[model samples]
Target: MRQILLFAALAAVLALLLVSCGGTKDKPVPTEEDAPGKAAYHKISAEEAYEMMISQEIVVVDVRTREEYDGGHIENAVLVPNESIGSEMPETLPDKEATLLIYCRSGRRSKDAAQKLLALGYQSVYDFGGVIDWPYELVKEG
Candidate 1:
Protein backbone atom coordinates (compact mmCIF):
# COMPACT_ATOMS: atom_id res chain seq x y z
CA MET A 1 0.00 0.00 0.00
CA ARG A 2 2.86 2.42 0.79
CA GLN A 3 4.55 1.75 -2.59
CA ILE A 4 1.30 2.30 -4.49
CA LEU A 5 0.71 5.66 -2.80
CA LEU A 6 4.26 6.84 -3.60
CA PHE A 7 3.88 5.84 -7.31
CA ALA A 8 0.55 7.67 -7.56
CA ALA A 9 2.08 10.83 -6.10
CA LEU A 10 5.03 10.68 -8.54
CA ALA A 11 2.66 10.23 -11.48
CA ALA A 12 0.58 13.26 -10.39
CA VAL A 13 3.74 15.38 -10.12
CA LEU A 14 4.88 14.33 -13.60
CA ALA A 15 1.47 15.15 -15.06
CA LEU A 16 1.54 18.61 -13.52
CA LEU A 17 4.99 19.25 -14.93
CA LEU A 18 3.92 18.26 -18.42
CA VAL A 19 0.83 20.46 -18.23
CA SER A 20 2.84 23.47 -17.14
CA CYS A 21 5.45 23.01 -19.87
CA GLY A 22 2.94 22.86 -22.71
CA GLY A 23 2.47 26.23 -24.40
CA THR A 24 2.06 27.66 -27.92
CA LYS A 25 5.34 28.47 -29.78
CA ASP A 26 3.80 30.97 -32.19
CA LYS A 27 4.24 34.71 -31.46
CA PRO A 28 1.20 36.86 -30.89
CA VAL A 29 0.19 39.03 -33.87
CA PRO A 30 0.04 42.74 -33.09
CA THR A 31 -3.16 44.57 -34.03
CA GLU A 32 -4.30 48.17 -34.58
CA GLU A 33 -5.90 48.25 -31.15
CA ASP A 34 -2.44 47.87 -29.54
CA ALA A 35 -1.49 51.06 -27.68
CA PRO A 36 1.77 52.25 -26.17
CA GLY A 37 2.77 50.49 -22.91
CA LYS A 38 0.35 47.70 -23.89
CA ALA A 39 1.66 45.80 -26.96
CA ALA A 40 5.08 45.47 -28.58
CA TYR A 41 4.00 46.48 -32.06
CA HIS A 42 0.99 47.20 -34.30
CA LYS A 43 0.43 46.49 -38.01
CA ILE A 44 -1.42 49.37 -39.62
CA SER A 45 -2.44 50.42 -43.14
CA ALA A 46 -1.07 53.30 -45.26
CA GLU A 47 -4.21 55.38 -44.72
CA GLU A 48 -4.00 54.76 -41.01
CA ALA A 49 -0.32 55.78 -41.06
CA TYR A 50 -1.20 58.95 -42.98
CA GLU A 51 -3.83 59.90 -40.43
CA MET A 52 -1.39 59.37 -37.57
CA MET A 53 1.31 61.36 -39.39
CA ILE A 54 -0.99 64.38 -39.79
CA SER A 55 -2.92 64.17 -36.53
CA GLN A 56 -0.02 63.52 -34.18
CA GLU A 57 3.75 63.72 -33.83
CA ILE A 58 5.16 60.41 -35.10
CA VAL A 59 8.64 59.32 -36.22
CA VAL A 60 8.30 58.03 -39.76
CA VAL A 61 11.16 55.60 -40.41
CA ASP A 62 12.10 54.27 -43.84
CA VAL A 63 13.84 50.97 -43.18
CA ARG A 64 15.44 50.76 -46.60
CA THR A 65 18.90 51.29 -48.06
CA ARG A 66 20.27 54.83 -48.52
CA GLU A 67 20.12 54.39 -52.30
CA GLU A 68 16.48 53.40 -52.17
CA TYR A 69 15.66 56.30 -49.88
CA ASP A 70 17.40 58.71 -52.25
CA GLY A 71 15.17 57.52 -55.08
CA GLY A 72 12.09 58.69 -53.18
CA HIS A 73 10.40 58.31 -49.80
CA ILE A 74 7.45 59.65 -47.87
CA GLU A 75 7.78 63.28 -46.86
CA ASN A 76 9.37 63.69 -43.40
CA ALA A 77 10.42 60.01 -43.29
CA VAL A 78 13.89 59.41 -41.89
CA LEU A 79 16.22 56.79 -43.29
CA VAL A 80 17.01 54.02 -40.85
CA PRO A 81 18.00 50.96 -42.87
CA ASN A 82 16.93 47.55 -41.58
CA GLU A 83 20.52 46.29 -42.02
CA SER A 84 21.79 49.14 -39.82
CA ILE A 85 19.81 48.01 -36.79
CA GLY A 86 21.69 45.67 -34.47
CA SER A 87 21.61 44.53 -30.85
CA GLU A 88 22.33 48.12 -29.85
CA MET A 89 19.50 50.65 -29.96
CA PRO A 90 19.53 52.89 -33.08
CA GLU A 91 20.95 56.37 -32.52
CA THR A 92 18.40 58.10 -34.79
CA LEU A 93 15.61 56.71 -32.63
CA PRO A 94 16.40 57.99 -29.17
CA ASP A 95 13.06 57.65 -27.41
CA LYS A 96 11.87 54.12 -26.71
CA GLU A 97 8.28 55.24 -26.09
CA ALA A 98 7.95 57.47 -29.14
CA THR A 99 5.28 56.62 -31.71
CA LEU A 100 7.29 55.14 -34.62
CA LEU A 101 5.84 54.44 -38.04
CA ILE A 102 8.18 52.00 -39.83
CA TYR A 103 8.25 51.19 -43.55
CA CYS A 104 10.46 49.68 -46.29
CA ARG A 105 10.57 49.33 -50.06
CA SER A 106 8.35 46.29 -49.59
CA GLY A 107 6.50 44.79 -46.60
CA ARG A 108 9.16 42.24 -45.59
CA ARG A 109 11.90 44.48 -44.15
CA SER A 110 9.40 46.62 -42.28
CA LYS A 111 8.06 43.60 -40.41
CA ASP A 112 11.57 42.46 -39.49
CA ALA A 113 12.62 45.94 -38.33
CA ALA A 114 9.47 46.36 -36.25
CA GLN A 115 10.16 43.08 -34.45
CA LYS A 116 13.76 44.11 -33.77
CA LEU A 117 12.64 47.50 -32.45
CA LEU A 118 10.13 45.86 -30.13
CA ALA A 119 12.84 43.54 -28.79
CA LEU A 120 14.95 46.63 -28.06
CA GLY A 121 12.25 47.87 -25.61
CA TYR A 122 10.45 50.26 -27.94
CA GLN A 123 7.03 50.85 -26.37
CA SER A 124 5.22 52.18 -29.43
CA VAL A 125 6.22 50.62 -32.76
CA TYR A 126 3.94 50.46 -35.79
CA ASP A 127 4.74 48.69 -39.09
CA PHE A 128 2.94 50.32 -41.98
CA GLY A 129 4.22 47.91 -44.64
CA GLY A 130 6.01 49.14 -47.85
CA VAL A 131 6.41 52.58 -49.35
CA ILE A 132 5.47 51.11 -52.74
CA ASP A 133 1.89 50.92 -51.54
CA TRP A 134 1.93 54.52 -50.27
CA PRO A 135 -0.38 56.64 -52.42
CA TYR A 136 0.66 59.92 -50.85
CA GLU A 137 3.30 62.35 -52.13
CA LEU A 138 6.97 61.41 -51.81
CA VAL A 139 10.02 63.63 -51.35
CA LYS A 140 12.95 62.92 -53.65
CA GLU A 141 16.46 63.72 -52.53
CA GLY A 142 18.56 66.16 -54.61
Candidate 2:
Protein backbone atom coordinates (compact mmCIF):
# COMPACT_ATOMS: atom_id res chain seq x y z
CA MET A 1 0.00 0.00 0.00
CA ARG A 2 2.86 2.43 0.80
CA GLN A 3 4.52 1.91 -2.59
CA ILE A 4 1.18 2.34 -4.35
CA LEU A 5 0.50 5.65 -2.57
CA LEU A 6 3.95 6.99 -3.52
CA PHE A 7 3.35 6.14 -7.17
CA ALA A 8 -0.06 7.76 -7.10
CA ALA A 9 1.33 10.97 -5.61
CA LEU A 10 4.09 11.13 -8.19
CA ALA A 11 1.60 10.67 -10.99
CA ALA A 12 -0.64 13.39 -9.59
CA VAL A 13 2.28 15.85 -9.42
CA LEU A 14 3.31 15.05 -12.95
CA ALA A 15 -0.23 15.64 -14.23
CA LEU A 16 -0.34 19.03 -12.46
CA LEU A 17 2.94 20.09 -13.97
CA LEU A 18 1.84 19.15 -17.46
CA VAL A 19 -1.28 21.24 -17.11
CA SER A 20 0.58 24.26 -15.75
CA CYS A 21 3.34 24.21 -18.33
CA GLY A 22 1.01 24.36 -21.29
CA GLY A 23 1.82 25.42 -24.84
CA THR A 24 2.10 29.12 -25.77
CA LYS A 25 0.16 28.88 -28.98
CA ASP A 26 -1.67 32.16 -28.47
CA LYS A 27 1.33 34.09 -27.14
CA PRO A 28 4.33 35.26 -29.11
CA VAL A 29 7.75 33.68 -28.66
CA PRO A 30 8.97 35.00 -25.33
CA THR A 31 12.40 36.38 -24.57
CA GLU A 32 14.48 35.81 -21.41
CA GLU A 33 12.93 38.85 -19.72
CA ASP A 34 9.38 37.68 -20.51
CA ALA A 35 7.75 36.86 -17.20
CA PRO A 36 5.28 38.14 -14.64
CA GLY A 37 5.78 41.90 -14.20
CA LYS A 38 8.66 41.77 -16.66
CA ALA A 39 9.02 42.89 -20.30
CA ALA A 40 10.07 41.11 -23.49
CA TYR A 41 12.54 42.17 -26.19
CA HIS A 42 14.29 40.47 -29.08
CA LYS A 43 18.08 39.97 -29.26
CA ILE A 44 19.33 39.96 -32.82
CA SER A 45 22.73 40.08 -34.47
CA ALA A 46 24.30 43.23 -35.92
CA GLU A 47 23.95 41.87 -39.44
CA GLU A 48 20.27 41.18 -38.93
CA ALA A 49 19.79 44.68 -37.55
CA TYR A 50 21.51 46.18 -40.56
CA GLU A 51 19.23 44.30 -42.91
CA MET A 52 16.18 45.47 -41.03
CA MET A 53 17.44 49.06 -41.16
CA ILE A 54 17.66 48.97 -44.94
CA SER A 55 14.59 46.85 -45.63
CA GLN A 56 12.17 48.60 -43.28
CA GLU A 57 11.50 51.90 -41.59
CA ILE A 58 13.13 51.22 -38.23
CA VAL A 59 14.77 53.40 -35.63
CA VAL A 60 18.41 52.79 -34.77
CA VAL A 61 19.01 53.74 -31.17
CA ASP A 62 22.41 54.32 -29.64
CA VAL A 63 22.04 53.73 -25.92
CA ARG A 64 25.46 55.12 -25.13
CA THR A 65 26.42 58.46 -23.57
CA ARG A 66 26.71 61.70 -25.53
CA GLU A 67 30.50 61.55 -25.32
CA GLU A 68 30.56 57.98 -26.58
CA TYR A 69 28.04 58.78 -29.31
CA ASP A 70 30.10 61.76 -30.44
CA GLY A 71 33.15 59.56 -30.75
CA GLY A 72 31.51 57.21 -33.30
CA HIS A 73 28.24 55.45 -34.15
CA ILE A 74 26.23 53.86 -36.91
CA GLU A 75 25.01 56.18 -39.60
CA ASN A 76 21.53 57.71 -38.92
CA ALA A 77 21.56 56.23 -35.39
CA VAL A 78 19.82 58.40 -32.80
CA LEU A 79 21.44 59.05 -29.44
CA VAL A 80 19.21 58.06 -26.57
CA PRO A 81 21.34 57.60 -23.47
CA ASN A 82 20.41 54.60 -21.32
CA GLU A 83 20.74 56.66 -18.14
CA SER A 84 18.13 59.11 -19.37
CA ILE A 85 15.36 56.55 -19.82
CA GLY A 86 12.75 56.76 -17.11
CA SER A 87 9.07 55.91 -16.56
CA GLU A 88 7.96 58.57 -19.01
CA MET A 89 8.20 58.17 -22.75
CA PRO A 90 11.15 59.91 -24.34
CA GLU A 91 10.41 62.70 -26.77
CA THR A 92 12.87 61.36 -29.30
CA LEU A 93 11.08 58.00 -29.52
CA PRO A 94 7.59 59.23 -30.25
CA ASP A 95 6.25 56.18 -32.00
CA LYS A 96 5.66 53.27 -29.65
CA GLU A 97 4.80 50.88 -32.46
CA ALA A 98 7.88 51.64 -34.52
CA THR A 99 10.56 48.98 -34.66
CA LEU A 100 13.49 50.04 -32.48
CA LEU A 101 16.98 48.66 -32.91
CA ILE A 102 19.04 49.42 -29.81
CA TYR A 103 22.79 49.02 -29.30
CA CYS A 104 25.52 50.09 -26.93
CA ARG A 105 29.31 50.15 -26.87
CA SER A 106 29.56 46.67 -25.25
CA GLY A 107 26.05 45.08 -25.56
CA ARG A 108 25.23 45.09 -21.81
CA ARG A 109 23.55 48.48 -21.62
CA SER A 110 21.68 47.81 -24.84
CA LYS A 111 19.83 44.88 -23.32
CA ASP A 112 19.06 46.89 -20.22
CA ALA A 113 17.76 49.78 -22.29
CA ALA A 114 15.70 47.45 -24.50
CA GLN A 115 13.85 46.03 -21.53
CA LYS A 116 13.08 49.50 -20.23
CA LEU A 117 11.75 50.51 -23.63
CA LEU A 118 9.47 47.49 -23.74
CA ALA A 119 8.20 48.27 -20.28
CA LEU A 120 7.44 51.73 -21.52
CA GLY A 121 5.01 50.10 -24.02
CA TYR A 122 7.20 50.05 -27.10
CA GLN A 123 5.73 47.48 -29.44
CA SER A 124 8.85 46.33 -31.23
CA VAL A 125 12.30 46.52 -29.62
CA TYR A 126 15.43 44.65 -30.66
CA ASP A 127 18.91 44.63 -29.10
CA PHE A 128 21.68 43.87 -31.53
CA GLY A 129 24.35 43.49 -28.86
CA GLY A 130 27.37 45.86 -28.60
CA VAL A 131 28.79 48.07 -31.30
CA ILE A 132 32.14 46.40 -30.61
CA ASP A 133 30.82 43.30 -32.37
CA TRP A 134 29.73 45.30 -35.41
CA PRO A 135 32.07 44.58 -38.33
CA TYR A 136 30.52 47.19 -40.61
CA GLU A 137 31.64 50.75 -41.00
CA LEU A 138 30.63 53.38 -38.45
CA VAL A 139 30.32 57.08 -39.18
CA LYS A 140 31.82 59.69 -36.86
CA GLU A 141 29.98 62.83 -35.83
CA GLY A 142 31.37 65.96 -37.47
Kindly list the per-residue Cα lDDT of model 2 for residues 27-106, writing each as its tens digit: 66666566654446789999999999889999999999998998989999999999999999989999998899999999
TM-score of 2: 0.74
lDDT of 2 at 119: 88
Candidate 1 — which residues are off by over 4 angstroms? 1-38
**In lDDT terms, which candidate is top?**
2
Per-residue lDDT, model 2, residue 58, is 98
Backbone collisions counted per model: 0, 0
Instruction: Give the 10-residue window scoring lowest on summed lDDT in candidate 2.
Output: 23-32
Candidate 2 C-alpha error for residue 128, in Å: 0.2
